[model samples]
Target chain A: MVEITVKVVGQRTRRLKVDPGTTIAELLRRVGQNRETVVVRLNGRIVAEEERLKEGDLIEVIPVVTGG
Target chain B: MLRCSFCGRRAVYHRRYAGVFLCDRCLIKSVERRFRRAINENKLILPGERVAVAVSGGKDSVACMHLLHDYCRGKRCELVAITIDEGIKGYRDESLPIARENAEMLGVEHHVVSFREAFGATLDEMVKVAAQRSTGLNPCTYCGVLRRSLLNQAARELGADRLATGHNLDDETQAIMLNYIRADLSRLYRLGPGYSPRQGFVPRIKPLREIPEKEVALFALLKGIKVHLAVCPYASGIHMEVRDFLNSLESNHPNSKFMILRMFDEIKPHLEAAVPGFEARGCESCGEPTSSTLCKSCELLQGLGLMRRRKNLIFVEPS
Candidate 1:
């Protein structure tokens, strides 16, 4: 299992271990996070929902809706 | 003409059982058909591309998603439904379940993205902040900018080739008026049924651009699509003023909306020539594709003390 870091916007960052073949959407949903509340960028590139993420991937999930 | 039970307006016919009566002026068939043709004419969607429909759980958006899903059946193109949760206390929560249920019933892929986690604050918070900074300006101005930016980014992440919105004829007409009121010539030129893809920006297409507001409601009812019938609370006082103005115009002229659209068509050539196409550039602060050195989304974040403000200022919209 590869270690991955998930940095959610407005929330603290967390690390997780997963297989390299996991889809981004699946990983997001697995983390008990609503897929609708955030957008994920893997290593500076926008990660598509169908994208299979690799081990040691640093992902930033940014929320699209803003208040102010 | 049959009078409407709710609004008490004279309609051409009564739908019976549904109890909603519509006049030729109210029926949206002609407008819907015209909009369909306009979308086809503009070549907004390719044969096999996937389109993400921005569903707002309203009559217009729901009808748009359903129509596009049905229209693309068995075709190479597929339809997906997406909703943006603005994090308004009671508004977004109520609409989300309805949007999800509609997507499930339609057998299309659906996704929701929220504002609280994304912006470090909810819309209610943002409105409070903005109000504290400046009085009189509505929260909708910020909300519209934020929602548009989010939808585009979310659609891109979803691998959608095109983004479809349910902006009907009335919306389009009001937008025209708003642009005119602002004297924003560039935006007025860009307002229409189609938007082409730019370097970093995904293309957005409006399939319901020609459909009237009333017809969209009728279509939703006839299609049996579950839609949130409540008006937005945030839309109660000020924004309703603009809508009431438009409604008055429609009531007096009946075909006023269509006439306004026709005016757009007449001015299309001039508008295209006068307005420059959208250019995508990396945001100086966040590297997002923004019209300016920094994107509006980033700007709002900076204003909210979330993202750092970019020092390099390129293009700024005149307020």
Candidate 2:
């Protein structure tokens, strides 16, 4: 099992152990994060909810925003 | 007498969908036909270009995606589905799943771009801050800026040749009214089914520009597309009131919206020649295309500290 740590900007970070084949959507729901209110970036690249996470990936979940 | 599902007026015409009825007046300006006409008139899709449909899981967008997919099939154009997740909590959450389902069912490639990591803020956060600072300003002003910026960037990054939206007749008319009210002739001139490509920017095409809102709803129903039928929680207060006023006027005068759009079309030629080029120039700050040194999206993002503010915000007077 690949251990992945999820960190959200302006929020707390959490770690989870899962198979490398886990999709971003499943990981987000597991972390008690709302999929609509945030976007996930894996290792500095924006990954869609349907994208799967690989081993030792550092994921950053950001929120959707608007202004100006 | 049965009333229309849309306006609750006397039902005057039968729609293709069962249990759906439209007034004779509404049937005349049906959304499907309007969309077909818009595409025909504007030459929105080419023979072999890959087109990306922007879906928001709303009726208009879902209808647009389905229509474009069906229309482009034999035409040899590829249709990909793109959705922008604005991170509006419950509002955007429910819609994403529906959009994905629609894309999957259609067997089109689907991509989603979000604002969370892109800007480090959510729609909810922005609205909260805007409410505190600018009490009366509309949230759409911000949402529109961000969504357009992110969508354009995402589409380009995804290698889409053209970006398609579900902006229908009512939206075009409302925008025309707002532009006229603000004397924003430049923007008014730019409003249409197609936006010409400028330097460093990809072109955007709207196949539903001439379709009415009601017709879009009908098309969605007839096509059996599941739409996220919820109003944006932030679209209340003054902005909703303005839309309500316009809708009431449109209800009373069935052709009023189309008439307004016609006026815009009539004036477009004159405005195009007179107005200086609305080309994309590299942003001095972010290197994106803009009418000025910095693009509007970057300017707004910089204002929120999501991006570094490279240049001072220049407020152009609507000439």
Q: Total clashing residue pairs per candidate?
A: 8, 3
Candidate 2, pairs of clashing residues: A62-B116, A63-B116, A64-B122
- Candidate 1: TM-score? 0.71
TM-score (2 decimals) of chain A in model 1: 0.81
Instruction: Write candidate 2's Cα lDDT for B177-278 as tens digits.
Output: 777878888788879889866855568998888765655654554445798766787765544454555656764455667778888888888887767776
- Per-candidate alpha-carbon RMSD to the true structure: 20.0, 16.9
- Regions of model 2 farther than 4 Å from truth: A1-68, B1-31, B131-137, B237-239, B308-319
**Model 2: fnat (fraction of native contacts):** 0.00
Q: Indicate the residue-level lDDT of B267 in model 2.
A: 81
**Per-residue CA lDDT of candidate 1, range B171-194, in tens?**
788788777877889878778888
Q: What share of the true interface contacts does candidate 1 keep?
A: 0.00
Q: Each candidate: what lDDT?
A: 0.70, 0.71
Candidates in order, TM-scores: namely: 0.71, 0.71
Docking tier of model 2: it is incorrect
DockQ of each: 0.01, 0.01
